[model samples]
Target: DMTMVLRVIIRNRLSENLRHRFLLNEPVDVILMFGQIMQRNSFTLMCSSLRAHHCPDDVNNPVKEVCPQDTDSRDGFIFARDIPDRSTQSYRVQFRSLILEKKLGDALAIHDKIVSKDKRLIDRSAYNILIWGCGKYGYSRKAYELYTKMKESQLAPSNVTYTSLFNSFANSPYKSESLKLCEKVLRDVKKFDINLNYINYHAMIKAYGRCGDILMAFDLVDEMMSKKIPVNSETISFLLQGCLSQTESGFILAIMIWGKMKQYRIPRIIQHYNLLLRITKSCGVKEAASLHVFLMKNPTFFLPISLLDTESNASENTSKLLPITKKSRDDSAFSNYDSPEKRYNGLGGLDGLLAMMKKDKIKPDIKFFTNILELVPDCDTSENEILNAMSINKVQPDDVFLCMLMKKRCSYNNYEGAKEVLKLFNEYNVKLNVLVYGILATTCRTANDAKMYLESLDSNEIRLNVQILGCMLNNACRSLDYQYIIYLMKQYKIHKITPSKQCLKSLANAHKRGRQIELDIDNNVDVPKKLRQRIKRISYKHFVMSYRPWIKLVRNSEADPWEQFTVKYEDD
Candidate 1:
């Protein structure tokens, strides 16, 4: 017992000494203090520094602030300690700090310095960190170069290293090159016997999606399933978005993927259902109804079988414990699953679906009702069901819910009903966000009362976004009211909001019409110098990317011959 106690005391002392050494000033100080006698301790201290020095590049850029003076004279600093490991550790910390700050140039310089000074000190992780930082900052080409260098160094890369490389190539500006890199990585993962994780599969799928290669994305999904790696919900979401953007077969593909998700027992929430609805919109009413019926009747296979069994046992126990009386019979029932025949009987329509939800005690929320409202078009019964669900569940109607209501009313040419939804904002004391105002702006344009809503917005002090501004300009162009367009220009100027090409094109169209009416906004055949300068600063890439979807939806909503007019404006 005494000998064992002595051994424990000695082990504790050694651990304490190692801990004390790691708690020094920095990696450099620890190495200098112990030298070669504590090589493992020194190496560990250096790694810990990497963890300690990590900060988000966007949050703070260490390159903006001057590095410490000791980092400059590496030879002199190392000569003071006469140890090569210390020198390498010093470089690692500096490189890590620069990369974390998003100072790519500075980090590259340090990399060159480390190679020239001593290649022995730099390891795989040092290269991986720099690659990750470069990828994150959109310098994917640089990350690839570093990846190649890492291979040449003969250091075997880990899963994290490959994940970073895959991510870098995915985010690369050149889509063709990114696709090539993705394929190469997929091959390498198998060749090297690296255990492929969900992250690796997700990055590959997303890369394919971004390149508009929806088929490749699905093929990768099949490969992922074959490997027995569970598909992530986020991965499915990306695939759905890619399908929506790229394929004629997207509707069928999305439904198939949804079914597959159920088969694989992948967890999904309302957000996933919303994506399904958005994708189904392109498929038409009949397809949407079929999807609704399928969802209502099908049991979610994602739920665990064991959990159902446990629930059944609990219910049986509770029923047995219940008092057996003639007047008050035991009513404890726990079986949640209905007969397959009964489930099929509930597939009549939207009302049937809602009744099934209520029968199953699935409390419907705002998103649930929004998706239902979208499916059942021009139905007062669907609207009443939404109101009843909200009232019973006490789910406060959000801006999205209100917008859907307004849109449905407008679709039925019930402009008065749409306007009443706007009034309900004040009645419900709901704060009007940008999206709500955008919905109202569209309603105003449809009602031919854009000017009234514009004035109402000013009185209400509702902040104006570009959507509201564009709506006013569009309405002005239709009315040949160039004065109203000028009023919108001044309103945006007051709000300090920049106009996009779409806004400018609308103004130009209005100018062509207003010449006969003696409207005075246009000064010449060419745009004014101030307006031209503002247009120069506008990014057409951002404008088109953000507003094209909105424009598509608006055009789809109502077919006006003027909708055929394509807005033309250049960006710098």
Candidate 2:
């Protein structure tokens, strides 16, 4: 029975990862995760999310004790203030819930308040939770302060505590100091005999990567592989991200690191492709066109199994180099090119862009056309061309134009431009849609803001769809907003929308990391580890993922959709 359960869990995770490589699930957080610029931005987002969820409203009001009557039903947002029972058991549950909601501030505030009022410190578990929260949000200074308190209480720091401590310093700005701190942590890990299971090394690699110590980062990655530490896509992602366009020679190094994924048998993912794209973006046209054309033509590269990758690399190596690459974009000779089409950019600009299109022999798909429209001289002419090409959808040409414009603006993080385009959509009588909202959500810096935008859209009576919900769900997952994930799942089921694969994968990733924490309370009310895990899995399968098989959901003279889903799936 245990083996079968384990098999089911592994299969679910595999399916989830496979779906993630599709890259159709467009969320800004996923995009930023691959980009080097997001390291500090992510830390900032984590901090801001906590602040947004936290209001300074007085907490003196009496609250009712609404602890879950059933152990299995004890899920969702439960704040510390809501629990009148001030026992350690209730506090631990609330602390984890707050971490899930990304509310580290309130969690710490409540912890301090309780300790000060009661004239005693909490247990190691509470301190560990706070330290983990601090590390997660780049609160290295605060994490060390709590570590001191943990020692003062004579608590033996577990691997979790050490791992969070290492991770908390992942964003240290000093190069040599960061390296020295990382070395010291490693020595401590050994001295304390903390079996961190290689997570500490990952934190170290991230620390090195942030400080531009690419060599050290790769050395640690190679160390993990040499020792067979079960490296995942995230580990390689850090290595590749470290090679992100820092020096002029970064492109070459990025390729070598890119090759390492295949060497180690690590699956290529969307983030891997994005990292390469971001690095190749700075190279000359000849270097970029080969990869871009191939990727644009064959998007399956976004998935694990990329086709003709070797050929693409060969094409890139052999492509004709433009001498204009050495010249500035505005150089007189380079700018005054006699080509029929105006230069879109320096290396090849429109020339390279079109060349890529022609070389690949790809037809004008809607999305591909949207990319092209940005290069066109006249929006009206592009709008007409887009309309004729996409007329089958029956959407107004102006609507398409407005949506494309908004997407272009949102791509550049131009929230103001997107808002203007939205006004134009209203003025032109174009019905706002999921596409518009999805694009706008890209500009939202934090999940809380995204949630509000989604809620306002709901108030406007715009029925949500798979794209909007999936977009929000993916973003919430990226921000680690457990409450928003629940909200998104509820909205999907309430609206009767079938769970799209993208959304399912996002949901699966969210629930995959189950915490089987042991509680210290003597009360029988505390949830058991095994039972808690079982509930999390069951809830994900039956409630969140909508695990209804075909034979039961569709049954009207053997024809109705209701009988299509039944108990057979469970039996199987």
Q: For residues 1-572, could you state the per-residue lDDT of candidate 1 as single tens digits?
A: 42233234334544465345445533334433233343344334443343235332534322222123222233222322122344444455666776676566666765765575544447877887777776665455666677778888887887777778767765666767767776776777778898878887787777677666766777777777777877777888778766665434355445456545544655664556556555555432123233333434544422122211233322221222221222321112211112222212212334554554464345556776676666664766667777776777788887788887887876676878888888777867777677767766765542237668867888988877877777667665565443444456556657766666687677556444434322223443554554444233333223324344544444454443222212222211
Off by over 4 Å in 1: 1-157, 164-181, 184-193, 231-238, 261-271, 282-365, 371-382, 392-394, 403-419, 422-430, 443-463, 477-572
Q: Per-residue CA lDDT of candidate 2, range 54-141, in tens? A: 3225256333322322111122322233323223544566677777787777677667756665355577888888888877776666
List ranges where model 2 is wrong by over 4 Å: 1-87, 114-119, 171-184, 245-249, 281-572
Error of 2 at 170 (Å): 3.9
Pick out the ten consecutive residues of candidate 2 with the lowest summed lDDT: 563-572
Local lDDT at 456 for model 2: 77
TM-score for all models, in order of appearance: 0.52, 0.40
Residue 478 displacement (Å), model 2: 36
Give lDDT: candidate 1, residue 65: 26
Per-residue error at 233 for model 1, in Å?
5.3
